[model samples]
Target: MKKIEAYIRHEAFEPIRLELLELGFPSLTISEVKGSGRQKGITERYRGAELTNWLRPKVKLECVVASGDVQTVVDAILKHARTGSIGDGKVFVLPVEEAYRIRTGESGEETLQAHPGVAQAAS
Candidate 1:
């Protein structure tokens, strides 16, 4: 099993999530985050005041999936998240030793299948 973590632009979160659903990945966790990359933040105007060095808001998505699904999941994120613009975001794949479902006392693949949008996470 593995964990796919994607950090994406805040505005792109909804679209990305929808795309992921369409790709057969419904289980996901989203978090509101703030950071900067090459763009190093942006400029904005609010109440006639110009904002600089702003920490742009971003969305972090976490999901655990089978090894085979890793590429598919990553593709979904990159295909939808890419805008050829700065601060589009990044994706990281990490090793997940185990998983379990608390509700039914299921372990491994069953645990992942119990998640929101998934069939299984593989053994």
Candidate 2:
């Protein structure tokens, strides 16, 4: 199994999410985060005062998928998240040993698949 972590611009979240669902990989965890990358940070005027080195608001998306589905998921994210600008964000893939669904007692890849016995494609 693999875990996909993507840090994307806040504005790109909805499109990426819709694309993921369309690709039949819907299980995901999202968080609102503030971070900076190569661009470091951006400056903004607040009450006539310039604020420098401020962390930008970003959306952190996390999902676990079968090893075979890693590239597909990554591609979907990239397709929907690009904005032809800096701070487009980054995607990271890591090995996931296992996953278990507490309520259903489903484990391994099953834990990442859709519930209600619906076998989703690319899961």
Q: Model 1, range 50-78, lDDT digits (tens) per residue?
A: 98976778899999998878998898889
* Model 2: residues with Cα > 4 Å off, grouped in runs: 116-123
Candidate 2: residue 105 lDDT (0-100): 92
Per residue, candidate 2 scores C-alpha lDDT tens digits across 8-102 of: 98888888887788777778899999887775777889999998975888899999999999999999999888888888999999999878899
lDDT of each: 0.81, 0.86
Model 1 scores a C-alpha lDDT of 0.81
Query: What CA root-mean-square deviation does each model show from the true structure?
Result: 4.6, 3.2
Over 4 Å off, model 1: 43-51, 114-123
